[model samples]
Target: MSTAAPLPAHRLFSPARVGAIARNTLTELTRQKVFYLLLLFGLLLIGSSVLLVRFSFQDQFQMLKDISLGAMSIFGSLLAILATAAMLPRDIEERTLYTILAKPVPRVEYVLGKFLGIAGMLACALFLMGLLFLLILFVRERGVEAEMAASLSGDAAALAAQIETLRAQVFHPNLLAAGLTIFAKTCVLAALTLFVSTFATSQIFTVFIVTTAYFIGHFQATAREYWQAMGGAAWSKAFAGFVAILFPDLQIFNLVDEIAVGVAVPLALLGKTLVLGGFYVLIYLLAAQLVFAQKEL
Candidate 1:
């Protein structure tokens, strides 16, 4: 029998090779109807913010902010989990992974490709919802400002001038903080889903595990405290410590309330949290690569 040709190791890990995988995964994701369904649901939730604003008699701006921020978080989290889980299993079930693996592409490149593709979709969802949020906030703020101006007893001209000034102050950096915080929070959640997708064998299991992890990751500190209160119980403490190391500290990225209340924490603190999130993403992706490498097609 003729000798099989040795695969070119350098070409297998090249950036171009990885990018092609990412592109293919992205195309596959876009073609799936589940993505469009979620997008429609997300848009519907975002559109409902106008109705939410109408119900708030006191500080309608706060109401709008709450709904908009919440919609982004919920939809983004779902999209991240859904996309990451489905992509891997779809390839495997179709027997397409075998063909791809037979090429010069490494399994690690495949994982990274899937991760980045899902991430790109999440980023798009965030941007779309983020724009919707800004528009709703703008419209609500304008309506409130106009009402206040019309209620003014003095000249209309002076009232209009005052309203313009108020609008400027309303959309200032402090007010914009909520939007920024929500985006950061989405990144953390998306990274988490990506990490979990690496090990999960089935799409349903991946979604379930990632969703549970998302909820518990934020409360791990509370678990630690509970363990401490148990009087140094070995099993409890061990479980808490295991959780602490396994999950990313999600509370660091949760600044929605602080932003809503206009509290100014140091920007440096946010920067540090973002850096930690990045570290988690890298570590989890690396772990996923290691796992995927050993997994048989």
Candidate 2:
């Protein structure tokens, strides 16, 4: 009897197979009601941006920016939590993974597909909300400028100067940077959730673990503070370094304060954040594929 040697490991990462898996995964997600709910929630959060302006006492531009950014963060996080948890296990529970696994589809392909599917959903959510936020901010900024011009009886030059300053604040580059940072952060969270779901027995477990990670990821700055306060003790420093390696350094993507106040972020830093997030996402998916390949469905 001749024995067939196992296929090589490098074949698992083939782009063609990964692309096919991604397409199928995307199609499946589009057919679900959960996708619609997520879309609706995103829209609702965006629409509330306008309403939040009324409470700002005509500081509507800043208010609009705040609400819009906040909405993106909240909605993105929730979508990541819910969508990833339901994707894989639902298929496994229905024994659908068996059908897919029986074919030429590799475990790595399946995991990559799952991650990209959720990433696609996150991308859509971000674009939709980000566009709406931009439009609302533009309108609010213009309206506020008009109001300021009408109320001020100063010289034309002074009035123009005031409007320009306000414009600088409202249409700040940092605000745009902040929004993009949040979008990037959401992608990282989505990838993390998908990675966790690859091995989790239940959606609850995925949710619990991802949420904990999210909290810890957000606490990167706090963790640094603790390490500094500990006087650089070896164990404390080691623990902090371990955390830095294990969890996504989410603080890199937090530009909320800068956005709200219009602080400039270096282009280098922005590029670094994207690269860091992409690296983590790739590592996570690879790790997930390793575990999932041995899982008995």
Candidate 3:
């Protein structure tokens, strides 16, 4: 029997090779079945919206917006961190890393492909979850209009304006923007987690550190201000500056919270967030490649 010819040695870094690794990585993550959490959240969303109706209708809708968007942010971050953090160590434990690296693949391609796969999976999860959120919010919007529209007894013009406000608030473009922001944040977390996994001996260690970093990122601005306030000594100031430069400024992405409440974000700011995230992803992947390449398999 004849065997197929091998790919040219120089093409090892090509997209085709990189994409193959990514495809396998995606399949591996999918088999882990963590994505079932998305369905569970969808059910929670419906139940929560229904229960929220017994409380203030106006407040309930806003709460719905918060819960839905916030859930996506929380879930996406957890998936990105846990999934990417575990991947490298697990591959090593299973001896799969040696098998892949023993082939024609470059270390950079392997690192980059793994990140792409994790990111693609994150994007898919966010999009599906976001769509489900929009559907639930639409249903809540219609129910609110049906029950509250007539009950909104006021000056005719004022009542009409209030109704329009509710409608506009529920179906705003801000929801999609919030979804995109969550996905971008997930990419950043995945890259950072992958970088940590390169040297981490255990998955628990990687997860704990990444989770802590994520929490700190939320208050990066406040921490910076406080550090500046503590300018009594040069050593203290230098230490604070070093930390600030090392960790990402994650507070900047918290605009999703405001956007969920119907506050509009400028397109320029959103574009900047995506670009910043892209840079982090690029830098982390390169660093991961460098570290993993030198690691004893």
Which window of ten consecutive residues has the lowest lDDT sum in model 1?
169-178
Best candidate per lDDT, number?
3
For candidate 3, write residues 1-297 as lDDT tens digits: 999998655864689878988998999999998799898879889889878877887788889889988889889998999999889988998899889989878888889889989988998888889889888888877877776657766567877787798887668877777887888888999999999999888899999999988987777678778878876578877776777788887777767779977888789988998888899888888888889889888
What does candidate 2's lDDT look like per residue over 173-225, in tens digits?
Answer: 67667767777787788778877887788999999999999888889779878
* Root-mean-square deviation (CA) per prediction: 4.4, 5.5, 3.0
lDDT of each: 0.70, 0.76, 0.85
After best superposition, candidate 1 residue 29: deviation in angstroms?
Answer: 2.2
- Residue-level lDDT of model 1, residues 178-271, one tens digit each, is 5555555665665566566667767788889887888887798787887788777688788888999887667777777666555776778767
**Model 1 lDDT on a 0 to 1 scale:** 0.70
- The C-alpha TM-scores of every prediction are 0.83, 0.80, 0.90
Instruction: Name the regions of candidate 2 deviating beyond 4 angstroms.
Output: 1-14, 34-58, 145-166, 230-241
Worst 10 residues of 2 by lDDT: 33-42
